[model samples]
Every structure is written in structure tokens, then in C-alpha cells.
Target: MGWRTVLVNTHSKLSYKNNHLVFQTGIQTEMIHLSEIDSIILETTNISITSMLIKRLVDEKINLVFCDDKALPLANLMPFYGRYNNSLELKKQIDWAQEKKEEVWLEVLRQKLINQSRLLFKREKDDQGKRIEEFSCQIERNDPTNREAHAARLYFNTLFGLSFSRQEETDINAGLNYGYSLLLSIFAREIVLNGCRTELGLMHHSQLNNFNLASDLMEPFRVLVDEIVLENQEEKFKQIKKAILALVQNTYPYKGHLNST
Candidate 1:
């Protein structure tokens, strides 16, 4: 239930002191306990951080996301051995059958499409929403029929406009990509924390992709980013980026109770 997300966007000297993150910029100084932090976003190029702080964040299993000059997340720091017996989890991950992976991926697709359908309904596109709902149920193992693509076409067109395409290099696309990258980094941290491999994936098997498993696990959560992009189409600001990153704090139904990512 750790909820604090620290953003270090300005030029500052950051280090670990007395189990607290000490930030000193000019004459102003701030201290935050490590236990209160869930994640840290390094969004500036001018900031300097000590190795001790990095090691502490890793040891504490706190997510550390580094952003590019554009203020978009580019990389993250994840532990190689998050569990006591990391080898055992690696064996379990490899032992997972293809059928089981497909089954899990199918459920993920269903939930993603269902969320897309709900968003469509909220936008007053009832027919498109129902079509997406039907496709959610019809999706087979690994989504062989590619209902997700069809649903995406309908969803984006209805949500934005007929002229809007996800491929387009626009503010909306940038925002979605940024938010999705943040979500991917969050899932990557969780996966590594559980001794899971981020390179292996159930459905997103890409040889060039290093975060395939995170991509698979983050599929359903992409809709949350899409919602943010749709709501802030006028402009893309740091506030919008922070809002998308805060999606991890929002509670969602899991098992029988609501949980935060």
C-alpha cells in the first residue's frame, strides 16, 4: 500500500541520509523517508544522484524510472534477483505451458476489450461499444482472429475522430505512448519484484523487445492511459504526465477486493 510517488524534475543533489532521501537544491533542502516512497521518476537531465541512493532504492524494491529529454520514460532499474530463490521462479516461468499462457492472455484480451467497450459507451458510441463487447467474448487463445486490432480501429475512431490514427505522430499519440511506457515500467518493477523475467512474454513475443512480459501484463492497463489522453487532447503537459503516472494509485478490482498497482 505504499502510495508516495516522488518526482525529481529540477536540478538537485539527491542522496541517501539516515534512511531518508535528501534533496538539496540551492539553499532549499527536503527529506523523505524511504518507507513512504513507492516510486521515483527522474525527469530532468541536470539532476545528480548518489550511488548510495540508487542502491537503497533497489534494495527497497522501489521503482526508479528515468525519462528522456522529452520528459518521456526511457528506462527503469529492476533487480535481477527479487526473491530468495530466484532460480526457482525462473524454472516456474519456463515450465509454464503454452496453453496456460494463451489462456491467461485470452483473459487479458477480454478485460482490455471490455474496458474499451465501456469507454466507447461513455463516449456515446453504443453500437461500437457493443461490437467491442461481442469481440471480447469471441476472442480465442492468443487472439488469433485479431479482434483487438478491429476493436482498436473502432475505439480510436469513435473516441477521437475518423481522421485520427494511432500511428500519427501527434500529441495524443505521444501522451498515450508516454503513459503506456510508465505503466510498462511499473509492471516491470512488479515482475522483477516477484522474481519473474521481463524478457519472456505470453503473447508479446518479440526478439527485440526487452519488456515483453511487462507488455503482456500491461495490456489491460493501457486503456487507463487512453482515457487520460482522450481527456487531455488540448495539450500535453507535465501535469498530464503526472496524472497518467498516478494511475498506479487508482484502485481496481482484483480477486475479491480493490487493489492498487
Candidate 2:
């Protein structure tokens, strides 16, 4: 897989040339070999890309994310056939046992809750953190009682303020939404790269959602975004966005070794 994430923020024209991605702007032109790009984020609507480049991106399994006018991720382009055994993987996904799915979902929720509580504790909100940790233990299979939602309410309220609601129009909400979208796109890319369907989810079953599995898998990573947003509340959205994007480079202990997302 490619290792670089190229972000197109200004007006530019993108095209495929000589096995490279040609980026042309009013002042200069640059070329990056296709093999070096893991993904491309178009943060401006003023850019134009050729169909040839689009085809090359798909063929190389490079993700392409499009952002809205406000510079928030809106949609992404994913490959239809990600691997040679994609049909087999699809059949396996379709045949996943309900009990197994529920079990996996429960584990995912528990990890997410643990991460949230840890963050709260780090911020010195011990009481709320303990409450969230307790909720993790109480979570049932498939989260029938919705302990996740309850914990989220308490967690967000404590972290921001009692008056805070995720639906409200605020800078915090904007940062969180943007960070989550970036995480979702990364997870979706990995899912498709492994020949799994992004629509089949363990817990998130929204009919309108195209990336349900990505949503489900990204739960544990949400707190990372929250931590960055909380620390950089005074910074502009662009700076916060840079920090969130750089999260992929941060190393963490996983399964007895260090790993990066």
C-alpha cells in the first residue's frame, strides 16, 4: 500500500501522466508518482480531475475523499473489487453468525468506553470517567439498553459542558464531525482493501449509510479525535484539522508492539 496522503487545498487541475499524478496550479506544477500516494483529499470544490486519473486511482486502490465547501469530508471513492478473492470474502461476510456479530460489537463498544473513560480521567473528570467505565461493564450483547448512548451523553457533557449537544452548531461539533469523517474514510479504505463490504455492519444499521462497517470499527478511535479537539479548542479549524490528520502517524502500543493507524 502507498504511504503518502496528498491533500489538495487550493484550485488545481489533476491528471495522470507518465505513471505520476500531475498537479497544476496557477503558479506552479508538481508531479508525484502514483505509487507514493495512499489517498488524496480534495478540500476545495474549485479543483478539476481527469477521468484517466480517476481510473488510475481506482486501479491502484487509492482512496479519494471529497470535501464540502466548508472543507469537511463529504464523500469518498472506493474500489468495487479490492482483491482477487473478493467474492469469497463477500460470501463469508454474508454468512457471519448473528451471535458472533453481537459478540464482536460488544467488544468494540467496551473498548470505546474504556478509551472514553481514560480520556475523561486524564482530564481529571474522575467521577464522570468512573461512571462511563461502569457503563462499559453493564453493556449487553448488541447494546440492547444503549449504554453507549448514555455514556456518550455523560462523556460529552462533562468534556465540553452540560449545555453541549453533539447536534448543535459549534466549533467543537464541527471538529469532531470532520475528524470522525476522516477516520471513517480510513477505515473504509482498509475494509475494501481487505475485500470486505463496508455496508455490512455489526451494530450500525442505518439504511442511508454507505459506510456502516467503517462506523462500527471506528468507535474505539473516536476518543483520540476527542482528545485532540479538546486540547486545541483555541486553535482555528485548519490547525485542528492538521492535528487530526497527523494522528495516523502517532504510534501506540498494540498487542505487545508499537503500531500506527
Candidate 3:
């Protein structure tokens, strides 16, 4: 009923048929319809999208997301679905996101906490609780940028099993930051579609905190990030493509029924 978000992995085949994005599965190929899709997400070490396809996607107003080795959305293709400032529904969605900002923001925070705790437990029940506490405090701070900055620090520390410096702001890989930014925007768009305010954020700008709701809401889905990262760190990414496909195709209950939509 909204937008379709598709995730493809390393060296995966992507051909658009009408409004479909297709890939090979074993001997059979699977397809995701573009008209039914809100966004297309790709993540992997060796990502190669054809020029012709990319142009077509742009012209069609379909959002195309590129993810990095870390499986963070690196780039996105934005939709031109509205005319200038005359888009009434877009404005209403924006207004609604701002209206229900508090509840949405808090929900994001609580989910983030729960996800982080689950991650730690999954790794080792006796891991460092102190680190989790610190990460939680940083994420809950009144600045979304601060949350990302600090969260990246904590995340990398746990990720690479080493201490990280606050002074570093390196991209996960070359040309990858672009994709992650787009994916982040896609997530924000999803929040807006869910009838939550993308602005009036809980931990974002005081002047105009648009997309903070998106920032808050992406907590549970952060596992998608972790799953991508894990695959990249593997000796050989045999499962990287499979993992991405699984993530995008996986379903669960949201408002009432079980679905990834």
C-alpha cells in the first residue's frame, strides 16, 4: 500500500522488467515489482549497477538505494512524485510526522535499547554492560548527529573488537557513504508513510527536526545493518547476497498483520 523496498547483494543481477527488479535464485530468478516498490536497496563489496538501469530508475521516480560493505545504505535515488510546493499529501505527511513526534521518538529509543541489549546477549551474556549503558546514554542525547557519531564509535568498538577514536569519521568504504545516506533517507520516508512525523524529532535539531522520527524508528532495523556488516567481514562473502535478499524479503507484523511492507 506504500512503497516497496528491495535489497540486493554482491554481484546480484538487477534487471528492470516493466517495474520489476530481478535477480537469480539458484536456477530460478526472483523479481520485485518496481511500481510496488518504494525503494531499491543494494549492499555489498562488489556492487555494479548498469548505467542504463540507473537512469531508468531515476526517470521512473523509483527510489534506488546503494549500501556499503557495512550494509549501510550508501546512496539513494529520490522520487520526483510531487510538483514544487504544490504537493498536498507530502505536506500533510510532514505535518503529521511533526504532530506525533514524541511518541514516535520514544518508541524509537525504547526499541534501540532493546535491540542493543539483545545484540549483546546474543554475543555473550557476560559481555560489558558498561559499554551498553554508555551507548544508550549517547544515543538518547538530544542531538541526532551526536547519536550517530557516538553510536558509530560504540558500534565500531564492538564491531572490530578494538577501541575507536571519536576524532575519526571515516566512511565504511570508498563511495559507500553516499549509499548509506540514501538508505537513511529511505528509512525516514518509511516513518513518514507510517503516519509518524519525520520532524519534531526527539533527538534532533530544535529549529526543524525533520527525519528525527526516522532516526528514532530505525533502531530495531539496525540489525539489518549488523547482518550486512557480519557478511562483509567474512572470509568469503558466499552468504552476503543471500543475507541481503533475506533481509529485504523477510516479513514481520507491524501495524496489525505480518509483512515487510
Candidate 4:
């Protein structure tokens, strides 16, 4: 996997030449070797890209994300076949039993709640954090009792104030959404790279959603984005976005060892 997350915020023409991504804007020209890129975010609609570059990016399994007019992530390009044994992987995914799926989903939710509780504790909200941890312990097979929702309400209210709502049109909400979108893109890329279908999910099964599996897997990581957004609530959305994107370079604890995303 590559380490750099490239963002094209200005109007530029992108092309592929000699294993490098060439960027041209006015009289200035820049080139980056594709081998060094993990993902590229096209943050402006004014940018133009050639088909060759798109094909190269797909071939390299590089996540190419496009942003809307508001400069928020809207969609990303994913390869159709991500592994040499893709057929076998798809078969295995299809054969997953509902019981097993539920068990996996239970674990996912448990980890998410644990991470959320840890964040709350880090922020000095010990009482609310313990409550969230209690909710994590109470979750059962596929969260049939809806402890996740209950925990989320308490978590958000505790973190941001009682008056704050995720539905509200505020800069904080915007930052959170943007950060989540970035996480979704990263998760989707990894899922595809492992030769799995993003449309198939263990927990999230919305018929209209294309990244259901990614959504399911990204649950545990949402708290990371939430923490960044909370710490930078007073800053502009752009700065918060940069901080979230920088997470690609940060190392975190995983399986009793530190690993980079």
C-alpha cells in the first residue's frame, strides 16, 4: 500500500506518463510517481483527467475520489476485480451464513463502542464514557436491542452539548460528514483490494447503498474521525479536513501492534 494521500484542490489537468501522474495548472507542472500514492482526492470539479490516467489508477488500485461543488467527497473509483483469486473470494463471501454474519457484526459493534468510550474518557467525559462502555457490554447478536443507537445518542450529546444534533446545518456537522466520507472511501478501497464486494454487508444492508460492506467495517474507525472533529471544532472545515486526511499517515494500535492505515 502507498503512503501519500494526494489532494488536487486547484483546477488542473491530470495525465499519466512514464509511471507518474502529471499535473498541469496554468504555466506550472508537477509530477508524482504513482507508486507513492495511496489515494488521490479531486477536490475541485474544475479538474480534468484523462482516461489513461483513470485506467492507470484503477490498475494500481489507487483510490481516486471526486468531490462535489462544496468540496466534500461525493464518490470514488474502485476496481472491478481486485485480486487474483477474486472468484473464490466472492464465493466465500456469498457462502457466509447469517449466524456468522451476525456474530461478526456483534464484534464490530463492540469494538466501535469500546473505541467511542475510550474517546469520551480521553475528553474527560468519564461518566458518559462508562455509560457507553456499559452499552457495549449489553450488545447482543447483531445488536437486536439497538444498544448502538442508544449509545450514539448519549455519546454525541455528551461530546458536543445537549443542543447539538447531527442533522443540524452547522460547521461541526459538515466536518464530521466530510471526515466520515473520507473514512468510507478508505474502507471501500481496502475492501475492493481484498477482492470483496462493497455492496454486500454484514450489518448495513440498505438497498440503495453501494458501500454497505465498507459502512459496516468502518464503524470502529468512526470514533477516530469524531475525535479529530471534536478537537478542531472551532477551526474551519478545510483545516479539519486536512487533519482527517493526515490520519492516513498516523499509526494506531491494532491486534496488539501499531500499524499505519
Q: Among these predicted structures, which one has the highest TM-score?
A: 4
> Better model by TM-score, 2 or 3?
2
**Candidate topping lDDT:** 4
TM-score of each: 0.94, 0.94, 0.52, 0.97
Worst 10 residues of 1 by lDDT: 236-245
Models ranked on lDDT: 4, 2, 1, 3
**Model 3 spans > 4 angstroms off:** 1-62, 66-74, 80-103, 127-156, 164-185, 189-202, 206-213, 235-245, 252-258
lDDT of 1 at 163: 99
Question: Taking the tens digit of each residue's C-alpha lDDT, what string does model 4 give over 61-127?
Answer: 8889999999999999998899999989999998999999999999999999999999999988999
The whole-model lDDT of each prediction reads 0.88, 0.91, 0.55, 0.92
* Tens digits of per-residue lDDT for model 3, 1-261: 325566676465666566566676457678766566656767675655666667767665566666667766555554334234435655565565553655566556656655665565666633543465455655643445565445555655675456544244543321123323543675765554444445545446455444554555555666555645544645233344444445444675667988762
- The residue pairs that clash in candidate 1, if any, are none
For candidate 1, report its TM-score: 0.94
Q: After superposition, how far is residue 203 of candidate 4 from its true place, in Å?
A: 1.5
180-239: candidate 1 lDDT, tens digit per residue: 988999999888878889999998889999999999999887888888888888775655
Arranged by TM-score with the best first, the candidates are 4, 1, 2, 3
